[model samples]
Target chain A: MSTKTTRTQDILDRTPSSIALYRLLVPFVIVGLWELLSRWIGPRVLPGPVHTFSALYEGIQSGWVIPNTNVTMQAVVISFLIATVIGGVTGLILGFNKPAYDIVEPFFLSFYSVPKITMYPIFLFIFGVGLNTKVGFATFSSFFPMLIITMGAVRSIDDVYINVGKSLQVSRYQMFRHIVLPYILVQLVVALRLTFNSAFLAVILVELFAARSGLGLVLQHAMGTFNSEEILIVVTVLAVIAFVINIIFYGAQQLLEERWNMTSDEQMGI
Target chain B: MSLTGLSSLPYSKQIRLGRATLLVAILATLELVGRAEWFDQLTYVPLSTMVETAYGLLVSGELTDDIITTIGLVFVSFVSATLVALVIGWFLWRHDKVKQVLDPYLIVLYAMPIFVFYPMFIIVFGLNVFPIVLIAFAMSVTIIIISTANGLAKVPDVLIDVGRSMGLSRREQFRHVIFPAAVPYIFTGLKLGFVYAFIGVIASEFILSNSGLGYQISWYYQQFQTADMYAVLLIVITLAVVVNLGLIRIEDRLHRRT
Candidate 1:
């Protein structure tokens, strides 16, 4: 009580180590509280952080991570590719064709607003509860953003660039390769990053709904059996994977943008 | 003047007509194909069948109840998440150190499949609306926080100086200068946060719970009632469109007022 510190003074006095200490302090408090609560409630009702972490480690050691993670990754990657390709081409067509865009743009806007997972049952019925359905779900869920972003990118390319191509009397293919492709590539990369996240979530959702194997399946089984430790472990692993993938995409996007000498702010009129 | 009228009025009319025609064309084609049995049972269902099933569900009041449940969850979660985000965002703006340390983690939170935390939330809150609300809140709060902080930061130093020169206190300056300046960004955050909350609740209902439109979807799909499932899906899409359009109108009004 005698050694009271002012808020401004405390803030000004914070060094790097103190800042780090403060950062750790929140989680430490949270975990401490969790552990205490868990003890009071017992492990069956609520496992402590230590129990959950150890179980996660044991899960990794027991070869539970590989097959399920591989399945998820496969679905995510493949669906991302499909969404990008289809969405990109469709975006190009709509971006160029004003009439076509007018006809379809409103529908796409509505579709984008809706939770796309509602369409999953349709995909499930069509593709069955297999790789096809999962991939289809991932593709459907992820593609709209890609489509919208790509169309924006295409439409936003300065008229000057196309004028130069026209002045040189270049073929359509040549104009696209020389002018449009480079201009839109950076935007495509941004779209890819977003699509990856959506596709990954879609895979998890589909797996949770109906799947024989995957991280979503793991979570589903755990929740069903009331295996909180297993559920926590799988959830942690999925979060880490998502984090790592996002970092990689962010780094690559930055590098690509730098090489292209374009900032997203300048390009993203949309 | 005629050209202007044509471009402003008839042009928009033409576009709307074209959109309607395209929709009708697609629906008619699907109806034809469905009736003809040109595709497999899983692949095609007639528009008439879907409409009939939707009407049946509506008449029975089952669809209305489910819609109310889902929308109720979404609204509660969205509002709470926005409130929490505003408080945290204001605090973060007050403390630079915490903001800097937590920046990357917030990005991680937004990027990841936060629904994975649903199980843990379920354990904490038990198997009811609480877990679903928590799931929506977790998914959306980060987005609102980032946007709110960005908005607050965007309040110009010159504006604050002006407020001070006008003999305004700190709180008065914030209220008059900073808060108004940040309204656009805050609005954006609220809009996006609501979307995330909607998606989170629906997805959670699909996976975790048993009494919303999402649950109906899962239940119908499981029971092989494809037409009813499609009807529910259609209702959801319509709701999204209507809600979004309503929000757009409100946003426009807000912009005009500001």
Candidate 2:
């Protein structure tokens, strides 16, 4: 049995690293093949990696990319922050109080199902074709998922934990701070990741629809002018930024989950 | 602990009543403020006017045609995306090396806003439904791949071993065990894919198309026809809600079967 278990463990250990290396290799090969094909096909049909890289570098060096990217990121950050605070507070209220949940939960479900991009024109009319419109959409987009996740997280906490706090003569505030907060912290991280994802989509959608300045604007202009190189550069940068953000958030989630698991295990004497 | 209400009504009924009251209150407030012209500078048309205009638009063939076009685009894109994702996901499941190598790319693709590729798509496919479909497909494919792959990865080793012990062919085992287990995950992917595809289709319409609800909304915006724009917006929102509820029902049915 011990030997069998060891063999299984060995297989598991070997699989992940080999998989990682292969994952790394696939992109390089694809990029290389793409470069070769582009070179063979000519710039009109396809621009080579070198040309695209140069264009991207030039755009960055000339400060053409920075301003738009900055504006987009600003909208994303501000909207995400606002969504987080509002969603968190509302979620807590609903989760903790049955009356509030009963009153507001159905409304959230109905609105959450709606495709927000459909409302872009209304938002444009209300806030005009500006940063506020973009940010408003982003906030709206991020709010629902965060609110839902928070409610779920809060609701999932064992009643025993709350009872324990009460038994210890903990004040309502103390109960929330000591037990409720920590219980929801891990879930909050999950909600934050989701909120960020939604916010990113919201920003992109809004920018694509009507934006005077942003990466979307840059792409729109490039398309209009047939500036393939510039478009590729902007796209590559956005992809990289998105990739980095996802990786960071994923890592953070894993770390938080591990810590929470450890603490919970200790409490349970497991 | 206090789940049993003092009132004669069941807890669910009370909850429903509370929800209904809140909805009514919100709608009333919105109607009052809208009709009162509290935000006249912001919107020239009130909510009531917007609804009337929306009803008129619904009667017109314009709204129907746009809805049909958008739905067609969404359906086509979703089907293609799901097919592509299934093939890719299966390939990754079979080959450890390929799966590893493609994981980062997949992650990057998943995170990256594929909407940015609209220009490239247009350059390749032009300003037609083809480009819109491609955009929607790109938007949805990543979610499908992720969910499908995750689903496959989550299959129990014991189940595989049991199948092997039972002398089941690999293909048979995959069809019967792996596929069934992955249904829920695939449905999850489908749900997300549909939502994204809906958004992508609308976004594409907004960016380039001369027709469709998105185009209509944009046209109304350009004309400063606030009531018409709001009407279009309401229609879009209502359609989305209906589609979402439909998907949810499908998901629930599938879950029950599994």
Candidate 3:
């Protein structure tokens, strides 16, 4: 019975059309409810979706929104890149060397455990309130998860793999490139997703806290001026952008994991 | 040093000892640099002064109140996030097609910087605990959903079959089999959710509010009262560490019970 069902539904199982439809319907239902509620509550307290969408459109067209978004994206992208390179290198070094891990692991743990925003003011004073300062803060906040996850991934490699490489007379460089590098790549993908998320949060925090131009700055201005329409538009755009990025990265992670698992299975003759 | 002598110490203990020594050495170096005027140009108070100020802040009622508010907000948000995640997660679990449809949406929602939504929250909820709590909830809810879904998905099929064989209702099977199996995953999600919620509350307060530890830190920093700023920062860090450790302990205990 199970085999027959599996065979019969193989094609249907592969297609997620129903799921996609449900997803679309759910959001519409939610938005419809929100629109109804907001209309009932009135514009001053809760603006309807139509008003919010129009406000967002107008705000963007007026050039009030784009500069801020560009500035914020610039900071986020730069910091994210810096964090990835620095964290990847540091993680590789620590993961490969047991003594170094013992020496530096504690500091990383302590710092990671601390609420990073608490140190923002100090960063502000040092770096000043500009693009560099926001980027610096974002980088610092994002580096930890990448470093830790990468280190853990590297450390978890089987001793048997190392022994096998040794038996094969693999050169140090070859061992690193073939065995260590590929092993860490899977973990790195996961780390990248997390790091990107952290970087976004960090950049947003810095921009909101003190920025002359950025999406955060615009949101702050809207809040201060009590411009609910503008605020709604900016936030909705940011949320939509963030959501899209997350979905892309999640798909990448899934693909990487599948590929990695397949490669491992083939290598093990499983 | 003889390899034999080193081998006498357990590997875990050796690692712990080495880590502690490294931390102490780093702290000592910081103290020395702080004591010497070598980096006087650096905008930082000496370690001793910061510690002293931190102690003072700990004794103050204002700082205490701020800490309490932050913690209260985290707890409220975390509970709501957990409940929401559980409901959504269960729905997804019971219906695979729904899970597939919503997976993309959830991932996107998870990735988005929730801080961006603060303005909307402020407009809707006002510049009070509600906005802060909402921020925390928003930050945490995604984690709960992801973790809960993962947990439920990982439940062994055999267990579900056994529950069914015992004449358990769908709800009973969920409560008796699915929930217990999913608890660890849920707790893992809770741990991450709690951390994000804590940070979210503080961050919201920092950006918009006039009260809370984050606000106090910002206020002190703006006033150029470095000591007071450091003091508040220390209290905030201590609270975060304590809360994280407490959560970890709870997770461990739950894991053991399961």
The best candidate by DockQ is: 3
Candidate 2 chain B, run of 10 with poorest lDDT: B96-105
**Candidates 1 and 2, the one with greater lDDT:** 1
Winner of 1 and 2 under TM-score: 2
Q: Compare the candidates by lDDT and give the number of the best one.
A: 1
Worst 10 residues of 3 chain B by lDDT: B37-46
Worst lDDT run of 10 residues, candidate 1 chain B, spans B1-10
Model 1, A44-121: lDDT tens digits are 877888998888778878998888889999999999999999998999989877766767876775567688887887
Q: Chain B vs. true chain B: TM-score for each candidate?
A: 0.85, 0.88, 0.90
Per-candidate TM-score, chain A: 0.79, 0.82, 0.85
What tens-digit string does per-residue lDDT give for candidate 1 at B1-258? 123444656667867877888789978986887799876665657878877888889899977878899999999999999999999989987777778666545656778888888877787678999999988888879888987876787677888889889999889988989999888767867877888898888888888687998888778877777788877776777778887767656666765775
Inter-residue clash pairs, candidate 1: none
DockQ winner, 2 or 3:
3
The CAPRI category of model 1 is acceptable
* Pairs with steric clashes in candidate 3: A243-B108
Model 3 stretches with alpha carbons more than 4 Å out:
A1-13, A24-34, A99-110, A259-270, B1-7, B38-42, B161-172, B249-258
Error of 2 at A87 (Å): 1.9
Tens digits of lDDT, candidate 3, B176-237:
99899888878878887888888888888877787888888888877889878877887788
Stronger candidate by lDDT (1 vs 3): 1
Model 3 interface CAPRI class = acceptable
After the best TM-score superposition of candidate 1, give how far the Cα of residue A43 lies from its true spot, in angstroms: 4.0
